[model samples]
Target: MHALATITLALAAVVAAQKVGNLVPEQHPQLSWQKCRISSNGTTSCSTIDAEVVLDAEWRWLRNANSISNCYTGNQWDVAQCNTTASCTSTCALEGADAQSYRDGYGITTTGGNTLSQKFVTHAAFSFNVNSRVFLLEPGETNRYQTFVLMGSELAFDVELSSVECAINSALYFVAMEPDGGMARYPTNEAGASVVTQFGEDNVKQFFIQDGKRIETPAASYPGFPDTSGLSLDYCKSLPTNFQDAEYFAQVGGYARHNEALRRPMILTMSISNDHWANNLWLDSTFPPDRAGLPGAERGPCPSWGNGPAPQEVERYYPNAKVAWSNIRFGPIGTTV
Candidate 1:
């Protein structure tokens, strides 16, 4: 799991660098979670753990450590502030978030229990926040990320999307990431705790919660796969998709390779975002503008311009949108169900 960078997420890609600017004063949010182990007899033992979260470097404020000038601004590096990559790394610091900063500056809030709410757009008197993403961290170690192995395990969590309008995505998932955040390999990666540099989110769940009720669509609801709601390698291969990227996914490794990633240790992440680059069309509307009438092209009812840039329709239209997640549980496969 990783911090939400810009709401405009890219296609599949690896963000490897250990964020050169994390050396500055940092503050992480305290989020609670529970870990459970189930016995063969169906008994369960659970422990409450205090966890922390870190914002992705992309969204953190990067300023010259000694002065008030910006180290990187307007999507480009300030050469005077950072003459070179190495120099910039040592000179700039990525500021961390406090309680007020987390809410007003990033639209993030948490309670005493296991819950985190991320807002799509946050507006205050002097500042504005568009979207947010954060990664889970180990309870005691601020620089270390918490890890989970989910092959035979199940993760249960309730999500409230009543405020998450169309074209908005409030997602949570697991990814294979180094527990130490690649700090050992990249000595300069102070914030490399979890930046998502490895395999993508192949093993994941996208769900919504309503009025605290269990919101679920039975596999029986889909006429195509009436017998099973689960997806496997066979299902992916049999499903027809002419998208070039989908083809490339098969050429590189396909679901088989992606499936194996689930057997490894993974980090959990969550976010509420909307696409500024693609308008999230790929997730909910006709993509490629040119493929409007093609099959698999018209995926949702949203107009091509449905979710515009943050300053446009997205912010102006849904300033009050948000998503709440709570009642999280993890245990043996059937135990949670």
Candidate 2:
């Protein structure tokens, strides 16, 4: 009787475990959404989506070349050879009018200190595209903008002030190409107001928290809050002195341009840093025609603009700026599971 009872209990325990799903910890669980409660209004909604871990390995350096056929064998300072498409040559050049000039004066390395494993470097001058997919709940819904919220933090090491330039700009930004080949940029204010106004482009979207105060994009309109414009410059005067020293995190919550979602593969370009010829100058004097001439140009400095250029850009020009980041993550905002 004792043996039979023990066997019966073991079978019951197995059934219980099956009912509760797998008890072991998950390694890279599939990304999904679940319903969660909204604290503000006590309404149940799906706003917090699970994110994927893209760059989590320790000391994982950003790849200098995109080519899978031919590896970059040159010195650390030499320009990397990239083959972006399967049909392109091993040294395939970017397809743009200014591609030649844009590819010059840049290099990448992964043998540096201060990263997850003390090795991190920026890709060459061209954009390093981090690709990802956006989820769609249903089909047959075209023209609906798919909104994504990117959240992560990064730290800079060995940041140095430029000896020749008054200001330098480093930025991590998102670029989505339109069906017609036009591109829309996020966190557009990376160049600050003087540059944006001088170039005649709309102030891009960005949000930051510094010194316990929230700084919003200048003269920008968000999706849910259509009637409200962004915060003014006066509110962001008291910024931190050393932006590189802190672990800065940004949350850009908004819909895509022209209702275009990232359902298709999109590129997240990290223009680590760019040192301009002078303070408040755009990194490149001649803005690309495709990027310039945006609407709603505002004439003022951005509150979130760092005092120094991004550490990555600083490394590019001075080779002294050291920057590293934890893995970056992206996903939908309203997912609850």
Candidate 3:
């Protein structure tokens, strides 16, 4: 995996209300990570850093700052508290996520020292938490997020996805983001990365799985491309994914666009979400199911009814779906391995 040495992406999102962030004694969950240095002679040294995880503002409780009434409830804004964005921003405040809140309210937790886990579906205090997005905070700082610059580096981490199954996505990636969480540009965005996005078409899509089987091999690999473990503009340009929204990543310069962005510091984000948009066929199934006969259309091993179940079906069938990422180590290209 390519090492990400930066973190910064602004996710423009549409929430039930535009409220001020996590105000009530914000408590971020603790997670351990590290930065390593590799000498020319192959000497390696690593220093573990203490970090914290903050829940995205959307999942935090939004209540009237002066009272017990919730500003937003049951998928709707309590108009009495917030009839407009200004009203909502002024009247409601997003609450903090303690470790308990992370686990009970959002189904997120840090255990075994560094591993962070996200559950696809869980019963929360108000409703079901269908998905979650969390961010990493800088060490020794309460709210400032950590950043990395990953241009000539390699980022390595162990992922537990035996339970992640189909239609559900658990992700970890970097984006050029504001260290202060965009609070300066958008005051109402008291929370950082309220809605995050980056210039990439595929994240975990390179991993081809088919019911415990990885079908794609080097016979169809890009010229001079030794393996599927890595990607290049050549591979993206020539590979036939039959993406449901086949924009041809190479046409837009693909990772090239992102590589330029990486020149600056960027923020890291982790999340687990169900794709209601296209039933997540883009990840593990033949995205445009009709194009299954296409050479590279088949993506993963799970049975595909257009690539597994839709969001609703996944919620019902795999209520316990979860993913754990840990032992994250970053440094020179080969040092991490």
Candidate 4:
């Protein structure tokens, strides 16, 4: 009887451990991050800085439909806007290849302070894309905002999509500078004028963990554009409405196996979230060629151009396309976000 009781206790302890391992991450109450910044002289001289961005605080409107008007006027923000929208016309009009149309009627507002939320317009004809933006943490600087991730550094955040159906092509990624100090822009001279090519395949790496599976690849390797084509239903279904942890580590040394120059300094641009009408816009144009042949090679819920659903149909089929990110933290490899 004594031996049987001891065996039962051991089994109970194993079951408890398994339960603990299966538990998901609890939401963090506060978000914080730190990084090292190079001085304006562009030398090795640097300073370690710490900063906080209110993930749960009010987020000011960074850009809106009216903001796109600047695209036609050749303004400072025009270049960035045009690149992001993949405007086909020289004047950056709303109609053309890979063009995105905007209606001021749609906008996102923070709900409950801690969660950033947006409601998609029910009107069939109204569609638009906006990136709720945030700048990199560069404390105490006027003209220069320079920060870089070294080997063994990690970037992490918790995010969730409202609904996979509504968010056709929603994504989160990091944009950074090349070793030459030049920032990559969209619409490269490639055949499809792919955005990933313009960003320089080596300059950007996206890491994602979905339903117990981990996927890490360069943005350019994603065939056409960074849409939802390659993602699995289990992955999409798993996205939480509240925050869930995601991360990317700066493995420059790993990349240096291909290009040695990456061992030098490179500046980090801001992280971003954008919504789109097509879930797999750029799945056909992957780098290294192998990614194009992966399973679900021709799979995604979004319709083709002429076959797309009407406005009302779209509203009914894909409702509430938004994603919220919080608990953004970055530091050494073991740092938690």
Candidate 5:
């Protein structure tokens, strides 16, 4: 095994809301990240950052490598001048342009429907303030597909990139994961059919961290945001009648499930307001659970009138930091709001 040193692009360490108690600095602070400072201009956020990613692949030429002058000048002539200078018409190291010459390549999708693309490793300081109120890729509780693999736990929720853009950037610098990691996954079956309707009571306890030591304040209580002290990551059946109209919300009794096939841990942040008329912040003690089996399996019989079986309470992360929620949504993927 040999180690090749390469530097092609500038990098980042997004540090916008890096406050005191909201972060777990002692165990997982900035190590080797590219600096990224992204904010808003008006209603839209046009932020940019230079990031370097490390490529951990075998011998192959990159598209960006073509711009390198030294490697080309030295190797091109020797490749073209094989024997006859009069017949030398190429600038590469081999004959028969298409047969033995190198060409750029892309990753192939496997039989399992998963594509093996660029792999991004996050080992640096990173931060961002997205345009939406909830930092979710989708509007409601629904299932979506993500290409990254997430590992580690708690203060070390590290994310490893495996996409084309990530691979190209990985060739440049070392990148670390943000505290919450990347995308959330919805659990699936053998045929890839969504199991959203499969929630029940028996499995509600499996998704939560009840007795574990408190990591930090719930990310929902980040200063100006509402309080979310007792909500748990487990399955929730109902919502307060007063909290009925929060924009971009999951309605009570709505069928939702997570796409767990990606195997990435998600840090879902939510904001609750007391004023039923407008969005006001209020912390709820109970939260939803991961529905894994037949839809409505654990929910028992349906309610006669309102919605859901009944109202209940659960534990959740409080004291919001970068108040963000999982990318999971309600309804099918690609469906419009």
Candidate 6:
């Protein structure tokens, strides 16, 4: 089975990077952020903020079949759907402390681009690597908060070689969350103004468009976007050569501090569509629970874009999930914009 899914993706990336580097954002602190908003005719302006994203990491089930690890279920997966299990560990520790205070208010950093180094290595050489769960947006974004959503992780396993010397590890599964709602702020404005100012220059750059790839934008001059006519990004390394372009990349730093928060900015006007692939953002389960966008027996219904299980297992393994849908923007100066 592909050498046991590359030894379970190298023992789940050395036990989830030594247990998330011995977790210490004050001993288990999810992201956080409270309020934001502003709009003015006084100087070509726009503002908005509401950063709140959290994840109390402890959900393990990358894969298990060779023998079955007793049906794993690390639970807690509520990006705001709040399924259960104590309301998904209290909405993943209050949206992981509001995505770590929207990445420390704005001075975010994960040490620049082409990421994958903590020892996993990847400048683009291509030896092999995987085990990425996404969430990386560009710095200090005002109001328009710019249509957010950066949740990743699911290469499951690859990185080969278990011979000549020694290399084969895989086993990652962790979960935890149980703090209830107590710090949910963000709702002011009657004179108590502070709608997060600072405009244009927060650019924006993030990636992870895999399948058939194209993600272009090395731009000579172009970054328009009013209703779309310029800005091109969905993958472009060079005339379609079977690009999966997104091979795990992270650049997100802790948001709005309290110990790293994030999630304030939802004006929703961001465009980049292959038509919301498989329902919307790779949903899986073989959707039969009422079927939606892509579950074709002959392409009848038309609405299984985000939850899967049909359309012949998403067209027999994502037959180009709508041309591997993509559009991720911001990138001209300083690489990842």
> How would you order the candidates by TM-score, starting with the best?
1, 3, 4, 2, 6, 5
Give stretches of model 2 more than 4 Å off: 1-169, 175-205, 220-257, 261-317, 324-337
Output the worst ten-in-a-row residue range by lDDT, candidate 4.
189-198
Error of 1 at 75 (Å): 2.7
Please give, for residues 1-337, the per-residue lDDT of candidate 4 as tens digits: 0000111112222222111101111111122333323345643222234431211001111222333343433114356544543332232312111101111222333333233333343232533333333223234321122354444445555567546352244443443432211111212211110011111223433456566565554332333334433232223333321113121212333333323332344444322332234323333222212334453333443334343334455445555555555444444443332
Q: Per-residue lDDT for 63-150 in model 6, tens only?
A: 2222222222323232333444443322222111122321332111122122111111112232221112212111232111123211
TM-score of each: 0.80, 0.29, 0.77, 0.38, 0.18, 0.21
Instruction: Write one digit per residue (lDDT tens) for candidate 3, span 1-337.
Output: 1011111233323332234443455667788887778877779877898888777665667789787788878568898887976677668766665666678878888897798999988896666678988878788765467887766665766678888877888888875667766545555354433111122323211233345454442334434432543455545554544223465665676776757765677777789988867787878777567777666667776567744576788889888999887877666554554
lDDT of every model, 2 decimals:
0.64, 0.25, 0.65, 0.31, 0.19, 0.21
Clash pairs for candidate 4: 223-285, 223-286, 224-282, 224-285, 225-282, 228-279
How many Å off is the CA of 124 in candidate 3? 4.3
Candidate 1 weakest ten by summed lDDT: 4-13
TM-score (C-alpha, index-matched) for candidate 1: 0.80
Candidate 2, residues 1-337: lDDT per residue as tens digits?
Answer: 0000001112122222111111111121112222233466655344433321111111112122243222222323124433332322223211111212122212222222211111123244543412111212111222111232222111111222233232334443344422111111211111000001000012123344445465554443422223434222221221112211122221232233312233343333233333333323344332222333332122233322334355445445544333323223332232221
What stretches of model 5 exceed 4 Å from their correct place?
1-242, 246-256, 259-337
Candidate 4, 107: how far from true, in Å?
Answer: 4.1
TM value for model 4: 0.38
lDDT at position 100, candidate 6: 30
Please give the lDDT score at residue 219 for candidate 6. Answer: 36
Candidate with the larger TM-score of 3 and 6: 3
Model 5, residue 1: C-alpha shift (Å): 24
**Each prediction's Cα RMSD?**
5.8, 19.7, 6.8, 21.5, 24.0, 18.8
